[model samples]
Target: MSEKPVRLAVCVVTYQEPFAHSAVCKSLAGLPQELLAHLSVVSVCNAAHGTIADDPVIEEHQAGALSYREVLRSDNRGLAGGYNAGLQIALDEAPDAALFLNADGWVEAWYLTWLLDGLRRQPDREAFVPTLISGARCVSPFRKRGIALNFYIIGWLCLRDGPFLRQLRFPDEFWLDGIDYWLSVKMAEAGLRIERTERCIAHNLSVSDQFGTLPGWRYRNILVSERRFLRWQKRPFREILVVHVRALARCLRYRRFDLAQVVAKEFAVALHE
Candidate 1:
């Protein structure tokens, strides 16, 4: 008898760009056929008032192998909402694990195997984040902290457990920013373990260039989310104050007065809430 291949769902959320859709689909095509056989991709395209033709790259990939679903949203629902929509689909489908990948990100052939292997080692773990490599540099991995927030610095290819992530919902109030941070923190608070994998997943996007001219409302949403997380974690008032002070300094340094004011207003709202 043959061993059953692990069932996996690859969730990719998209907005506006057809090229991103193509890139993601192409990357999936690069995976081995045997592994692809056990995978199902769920793509949520948040076009939100526009219609786009089926991505040719996706079509081409599907022709060769793998099963997928493309969800087209009539209106622009932000990242958290889009992801939540995908999560719901995954739950309905009932895969062994759901892998969330950005539409613009490309994965190596062994990406699923590597991530799944790590996940299998820790039966208690609910979520796993890959070692992110943007260009040539490795992004910072999650550090474990004691009551004093002690950080553990591990090897470049080390995997560490942090928090659990299951049936976790992103706060609807925030449109963007701080979603990832808040999710991680909340998972920790829920006592669910999150692990960082040893393999590096390449991210081609540039962080600085992406948020160049984001509007004030979006920044306000971020501040609101951060405050919500702080409250959820039951952080000390002194610690919260310190975090805000640092945030204010960064805002001033960047001359983001609009964001600064929005954050200030959000602080008042947070206090009352």
Candidate 2:
């Protein structure tokens, strides 16, 4: 009789950057063949200009590969929607665990091992997030003490057997920002523990050339997302306004009027309405 394989799934969402896609493929290629044997990866390409049906880099990786699935989206569904789409496919595979990896990020050889060990050891933990490092330094907000980070950039490693999975579903309403925060909050609300591993995963923080550089819209979306999170958390409007005002004051005091002006304007409007 053959032993049952320990099933695992990796989910990734991608845009139009071929280089980022290549980087992700390279990172996956670095994993051990034995580990790869029990794993499946689902990649979703969310490009507005039509999906990439095939890429030479991914084809090279898939050449003789034992475990993987690639899904190309015909239309761009934004980040949150793309991830959810990938997650749904991953869950359908009925893997013991599912990990979300960014196409722009790279993982160390033992990254999956560490995550799996964490989940195995702590049977109660619903999800585990690895520490995000840029080159040799940890760049994640969780790196610092007392820092209230609102996002999980390294993506999430979720255990399938936990009640958290059944209790929580990603909100499709959020266009981008605050999705991770809302998920984490929902997991906590369900009494499922969320843990962070000390292992560092490398994340490439490069902006896409094709996306064109526009900081204004990005900042505006962030403010709108924060407001949505505050409302979801059931925070009073007055309290949310006060928090934004304080953030603006701090930014101004630090001589960051560029950021202060943005927060102040958004908060002023949100407060009034």
Give lDDT tens digits, candidate 2, residues 151-238: 4553645555545553345676675666666765555456556677776666644322211333656656667777787777677676
lDDT of 1 by residue, 196-264 (tens): 667676554333333446577666665666666566667766555665666567677778787677667
Question: For each predicted model, how many residue pairs clash, with residues at least 3 apart or on different chains?
Answer: 7, 0
Clash pairs detected, candidate 1: 48-75, 48-76, 163-192, 163-193, 163-194, 164-192, 164-193
**TM-scores of all candidate predictions against the true structure:** 0.70, 0.74
Name the best candidate (by TM-score).
2
Indicate the residue-level lDDT of 181 in model 2.
Answer: 64
Ten residues in a row with the worst lDDT in model 2? 205-214
